[model samples]
Target: MLVTGCAGFIGFHTARRLLTEGYQVIGYDNLNDYYDQTLKQDRLHLLTTNPSFHFVKGSLENIELLQHLFTTYKPKIVLHLAAQAGVRYSIENPHAYVQSNITGFMHLIECCQLFNVQHLLYASSSSVYGGNDKIPFCTTDRVDQPISVYAATKRSNELFAYTYSHLHHLRATGLRFFTVYGPWGRPDMALYTFANSILKDEPISLYNNGKMERDFTYIDDVVESIYRLMKKGHLQTRNTLHEIHNIGSNSPVQIEYIVQLIERELNKKAHKRYTPIQPGDVKRTYANLQTLIQAIQYQPTTSIEEGVRHFITWYKQYHNILD
Candidate 1:
């Protein structure tokens, strides 16, 4: 099993779960200071303690390195989760998206073809839904339009997966993840940032004046969904060689509600500042889980309250912040 971005939020959890389930996992991550490399290193630490885990520190941008890893390991299942992730950051550095998401993804998939990798499970984003006002975004909906460069690059990944699946018969599954949050999450995410700032008496930026809503999927649910899909793809006959599904909480919550939850968990009143919605950001993102439900019988069970509390607990402990 090859898990790219193993130091990242989703990838870390996914790799850990797979390792616990008795799989020899190859964990690859650039350990970029996108947020804090210490957090990434810590996540990698947990996995490295296991004898079956092998860690590689490198970027997906290096095609030769990716090709060499693919050839050497020849991973049967490549979980491509590494990417320059951030909607706001994409606005500032469009070239980074093109390099990491577009160019890096192409090299990764080409290596998959060369290695004859059986199943390719890569990460897509709910942001691909773009500016559609439709409630609970559906996988069947057309995604020709993208509001952000980050989203555009993810959509491109799906297209690449489809082409690869069609041409090479590589079983590819592109998971469109909704707003995922939990322990060990990226610091830039709303939940973490809000909690961190609130705990430190720093003002929290409420975008769209706290009107934005998101389907905040928990990390455990996401990992379980990924594990099930990977196992099924590995075991089952090639009935569906090319497929896409939305991995989300399946429950939409307002931005204010999440803030309230975090504030309550930390027992601190947030210093909130209302702000205009940033470009390349959607006002709302809700997932239609009918497709995911039917495919894997998967349903996200974590509530906002429980997820928030769990995250707060971990955050305080990780940072050694006493209430």
Candidate 2:
């Protein structure tokens, strides 16, 4: 098994899960300074402790390195979770998205084709839905419009994977993840940022006057879905080699409710500053899980309250906060 971006939040958890399942994992990551490098290192450190996990410090942009890794391991399944992630950051660094998400993704698919990988499971984002007023977005919904470069790249990945599946019969699955959060979450995300600001008595920016809703899928649920899908392979799909599904909690919670949950967990009041919604920011995301349930026979089950509490506990321990 080859897991790209193994140092990242989702990638780390996914790699750990695979290692625990007794799979020898080839973990690849660039360890970029997109967030805190220390956090990435800490995640990598835990994975490296397992004898089944082999870490490779490299970027997907380097086709030669990817080709070398593919030739060496000849991984049967490629779990592609690597990308220049962040919606707002893509605006400031559009070229980075082009290089990493677009160019890097192309290199990856080419290698997967040449290496004859059995299955390629890659991460997509709900951002591909754009600012649609539609509730409970479905897989069949039109995704011709993407607000951010990050989203466009993700949608492009789906298209590219579809092309490969059609042309070369490369079995691939694209998981369109909703707002995934929980323990060891990204610092740039609302949950982590809000908790940190509240702890420091700093004001947390409330975009769109905090009038937003999100399908906050838990990390564990996301991993479980990926594992099941990977293990099941193309058994469920009778006709096509390419498939796409929305992995989400199927429950949209208001932004205010999330803050309240965090405040309750931390026993602190948040300082809020209402602000206009940032560019590429969506008003809401709700997943229609009918398709995912049919495929995996399951959906994300972690409730917002429980997920928030778990995250707070991990956050406190990680930051050495005593209270």
Best by lDDT: 2
Candidate 1 local lDDT, 108-222, one digit each (tens):
9999998999889999999999998778799999998999999999999999998988888889999999989999999899888898798789998888988988999999999
lDDT of candidate 2 over 119-189, digit per residue (tens) = 99999999999987777899999998999999999999999999999898899999999999988899999
Q: Which stretches of candidate 2 lie over 4 Å from their true place?
A: 234-238
Give TM-scores for every candidate, taking all chains together and pairing residue i with residue i: 0.98, 0.99
How many clashes in each structure? Answer: 0, 0
> Top model by TM-score, which number?
2
Residue 298 lDDT in candidate 2: 89
lDDT of candidates 1 onward, in order = 0.90, 0.93
Give candidate 1 regions above 4 Å deviation: 235-239
